[model samples]
Target: MTDQAVADDGPGSTGGRLTTRETAERLGVKPETVYAYVSRGQLSSSRAPGGRGSTFDAAEVDALARRTGRREQPAPAGELTFRTGITLIGDDRYYFRGVDAVELAGRHTYEEVAEWLWTGELRPGVRFTAPHEALAAARRAVGALPSHCGSTDRLRVAVVAAAAADPLRFDLSREAVLGGARSLIPTMAAALPPAGGEAADSEDTSAGLARQLWPKLTARPADEASLAVLDTALALLIDHDLAASTLAARVAASARAHPYAVVSAGLGVLEGPLHGAASGPAHRMLTEVVERGGAAPVVADHLRAGRRVPGLGHRLYSGEDPRAAALFDLLAQVPQAAPALAAARDVVATTARHTPLHANVDLALAALSVATGMGAEAGETVFAISRTAGWIAHALEEYGERPLRMRPSGHYTGPRPPQPLPDATEAPSQ
Candidate 1:
């Protein structure tokens, strides 16, 4: 076909396609970077028809090049913008600093993933250890909380106590924030009381956060498969692009709150039903589905009560959640997870006939908690712990920005008044 005829066709035409090398050259990047861009969903690639290398749409490539140029320009005055190198969400997948999050979770430990998110560098086999004083204070604060307090409440208290014990907590410098984050994550994990009132283990204090956290969520001994699932979940949950809680953290950091306070702000938002605590309802729903031996009745109950089904859909993804896909792949290896997993699948299939929503990370988390003998609130604990790394990453970014840049003028919508004042003796208006 002639090039003109090919161009007359749509973007799918061969004339509109560029090879990897061409795409790299057009974008002024290396071939490897082109692949990275594709993985990050900045560019999409499709296999050449028969048996050839990947091809990119020429139009798409040029558009991306234009975007790259525009990104270098500064924001206009009186406009607030947040530019981050942390996480990117697009094309039904999420990336952590240009690396595919699922691939990172599969290849690296949670600590390593957390480190990479914070510093953009990976140190394999690195471990986080809580300082003695911080752990002690956190434990004391958590212990003082009423037994009925939820995991998020205890975590909130733990963060406050840890901040109080750190003499250098107010330092917003990069090195100081990094030091605090490295110690604080482990402290949060170790501070929670062990399941069934078991005595704390000295050795657990030095373990990876996932190892330290497993016992706190459930009394069951950690097995190889279950531990793997937990660690992967933590790694995958590290950060999503400006989630509600992460935005809250950045807002606090914009005001120059210390790292601990940044995390506290995040935790405060995280505990709300729509954010971190979302998984708890999913966990309960999955449990009921398993016990009832069917998803229909349980799903019906949710609809009957006028409640949205939990853990089924995500606002950001039209397809399956990448995190859920990764965790479900790991969960398949755990023999104990089969029933819960099946129930989760059934819930999706059942709901699919009507709404066609895919299972989100919360449903996968619910399966993990149910299969591993964790309480309904276990997922919330896991969420709060995992997202601490993300919150700190955002704080680090915000600490470098103009202070209080997030503050905005309110657009008044209320009744404008200077007309009258209510008399104290007059009857109040209905």
Candidate 2:
């Protein structure tokens, strides 16, 4: 490879280019090492006008040379730092766009809350309206699932159908995405199998999402108070900063994936037991305590078995999770939930007296499920649906950033390429 003459310019000047050998010489490394830098994106390379080996900007080579031999503390394994304006978790509280989530849960509808999260506009009367064809398509898709499928399973299928039906889903413009998400959310909710074995009246759409979703979760008719409790729960769950599923969604969006695919990526991650499905075990624990008529025996048995009391603690909150507290407060006001409320109280009191742990969002979701006579899997459904709003918001944010910005550098710790066996004739006797 010929070494092209680089113009004499100050170090890091952008005026000229350098060839492989010259670049390597300036960086004090071999040509192969220079290629490795290009592969790692530490340097950029281009082919000469004619068919030739790589050439790199002189300034970039100089910059790389200056950075050589500088050591950086490796980031803690799996630790990622990302900036988001959607939600904040601090001081044992959650805020959505600078509004305390607890306060928002008490007052806002899920539609209003979703809009606020997506656009930073807290306008009242924001609604997630969808065309009848979209709803019908989603319903047919969800209905095709097996009888044993859970609500989240049905939801996943419904979202896929909705995406297929929407011809404009590929539009990544801000207004287009926001409009698509607004319609997509309601369509998914409406398509779920109704708890009463019959769909809620289409007119119920105007009442709010909680009303529309109520019949899907329970056979019993929900009163105004109960509907309000579910609405608050949905609002509280709308967003939390950079959850695993949210991160998954953002990653997909950064690659310009369609919104439906982005949401699917998030749902796939949320299906993990350590994430969204955490409420299932928590529901079982609460159910056992209620059946036993006391928290002491059940709590002791769980501890003796080396099983953690699910839903009793959170990694981010030192005390009670604000979402849980808000949800519990609302449940207390519903007369039909008195028994489940009492059981939740006993569990909380017992855990607090025995350990420093406190009630978390999972426990609150479980209590809500039990109180409403919904099945154990209902909490995961609620979590999945509620979190969709957050996932979309994160997707929107990520679309505006550099594509594939989340690609992480690997630090190889595995056995080095089995040190090339010495050439047969050059090898010494072992």
Candidate 3:
């Protein structure tokens, strides 16, 4: 209740927490209605250290009510149209504060992307305090990770750790929202190692940073040709049209989870092997086959064994993964790729002829990463590299609402009834 609260209705009430029941009384609404506001992100509440129920900051709630046009005054019984100008969705495409995301990816840094996602823009016109401390705290967590931890896995752990650090992290103030977004993305991305083969001492430009990440698997320098391929791969994977991870992010946002928690939900779902790590195993399968000098027999044996060819199919891309095609086109340009590219082509033809399954984005990217000397397992990081952009966009989409929280329904199927179990020796028998 200590936080400042001011009633938006003519500045009548200001900072101090009010019980939900009391706040509901002032607003002339039922307690359930207040809970609905919290549910719908129209209102917020905080925990009481040693009490039950939640307390609301009068000023903040009033400000939100004012902004939302809620009042003691009556309104027309008919439908009244209100629209959010802050964020928009066109069919399946996403826009933050009206700018197209695909367009923003090339023109913006991860920092700007974060800002746009949280606040719509970074113009001085918008007065939002980016969470410098929160972001720094995230950095320390990322830095403390085992240096040898796979960059993607390390990011997952780092995200969970960062989410646990902030005291006022769930604050949905415009300032806190933007700051959290700005701090979360780069902090997560930075925690991920720079691309493989990047000189540890190189300047930290985007490209240089990418290099450091590339060699983790590649074990050698990724030449200029490979670098170009990597950059384009990143751009292509930057965003997708409302993916599952995107939905998870929005769901968290809707619940008033902080930006980090929103992104955390997203990255966590993306970590599922089916969605995120397909490319990792794909790269390994292809490399092992090619390296072992096997051909149709090996691939056929894989199919016969009832095992999946990891990267051969996709959900969204019907005939082909455009992303894979783009990556492979660039990958083909790498000098070291000539032999592997030919071998991969042969493998693709051979495999496709036998099964309806075709190579997907993962397969193509895994092949390309291998061609560029990215290790057989480098696809995981590459996927993360490309997907982080999408994660930020999804998180931004969630920020327009008030402080977010997520509470999902669980289907409980455990033992029922409260009776104590009979002693073993006294157990009833049919």
Candidate 4:
């Protein structure tokens, strides 16, 4: 292939065809950096209707070179047209398509919120076609992961693995980006695979729907109350201001790292006990407390250690997490939620007496999920799975505001370079 053809073939390159690596080399940076450029919409490339990779119009690259002082910075293939003026924090109580996050969290299902962000419609009546093929494949990918892994693990591994599998992960086309996100749902379901196990192909939407998450856990069918509770929980946990995990996700997105990688970064960050993994521990503590007949006492004991309770407070939100209030309200509606709910409250009050910090949503959801039979370990997974909606949204945001690059500001903690060694040791021997 000509150099142009090769450039066109590079991931997301639109002109004559430069492979991402080739484009990066031409631009003088790492392959990952090329993705950041593309993600930021800095680089321009076109997707062939039915082609292997995006083809860049070489002329466009030259135009970009002139625009950004290419000699100084080889901007990636796709660069953002506008600075992401959209700062998520305190801009609103919530948002859905520049709307409200809390409102969507309460009113929308995971699918609906996703549809809203994926398109402007809060409930997309098919303004855009659903990527059924990609959805099916995502389901297969999730189902293919280790069935025994917790939902969080499965969700993480599945998204990462699936991205690795995508042929157009770097394609800059809007439809392609949306299409990739569509896969996360079924992939998540596939990863969960229920306690009894998910079939190779669960064709029914109801079967694969997010609500069905519970049936795989308990022997009983999911009641409307519980499903509603689950939906609300999923929604409330959807997105936060770009958190550390969110930043990690954006880092992956900056690379034009496939959505899978973005989610993987999320799942990985979720692995940290301070973030996504915090819910798992919170749930476990509550359960152990309940089992030991000392929920409050135990929390008080932990408090003496100068540790804030996990899932109780946050850096943001001076008000009760609206997400928590919404979920706790939903939890109240659950038929099974009575005593477990009571136990959680008792624990919360006892802990709060010793500490001014309050119970965050994670605490309530963890208790509620365990009460509902989702299991403590599943809390993080559920959080991972549910937060995926937000993750996808955030990932798209990164897609829009990308080329999220980082520069090191290292501390010179280590010793300086040593002075040159003296002459031959043979002199000492002599």
- Residue 340 of model 4, lDDT score: 65
Q: Using lDDT as the measure, which candidate wins? A: 1
Give the runs in model 3 whose Cα sits over 4 Å from its true position: 1-149, 160-183, 192-199, 202-212, 215-219, 401-430
**Candidate 4 local Cα displacement, residue 34, angstroms:** 30
Instruction: Residues 1-430, candidate 3: write the lDDT tens digits.
Output: 2112333212222235666766675465777888898999878877644445677886666666556544442426642222232334444334544566545544544344444554445543222132445446655776687667665667776666666766667787766655555445445545554454343664342433344345544556557777666656555566565666766777877776776677667777777778776777777777776777755766777789987766776665456565566566766667777665665666677777767766677877777866766665466666664566566565554454344333435778987879698777866878
What TM-score does prediction 2 earn?
Answer: 0.78
Say which prediction, candidate 1 or candidate 2, comes out ahead on TM-score.
1
List TM-scores for all candidates, in order: 0.81, 0.78, 0.62, 0.70
Off by over 4 Å in 4: 1-87, 96-98, 124-149, 197-203, 206-208, 216-219, 292-294, 304-307, 402-404, 418-430
lDDT of 1 at 16: 59
The backbone clash count of each candidate, in order, is: 0, 1, 30, 40
* lDDT of all predictions: 0.86, 0.81, 0.59, 0.63
Give stretches of model 1 more than 4 Å off: 1-81, 421-430
C-alpha positional error of residue 326 in candidate 3 after TM-score superposition, expressed in Å: 1.5
Instruction: Rank the candidate models, highest TM-score first.
Output: 1, 2, 4, 3
Return the lDDT, model 2, position 21. Answer: 65
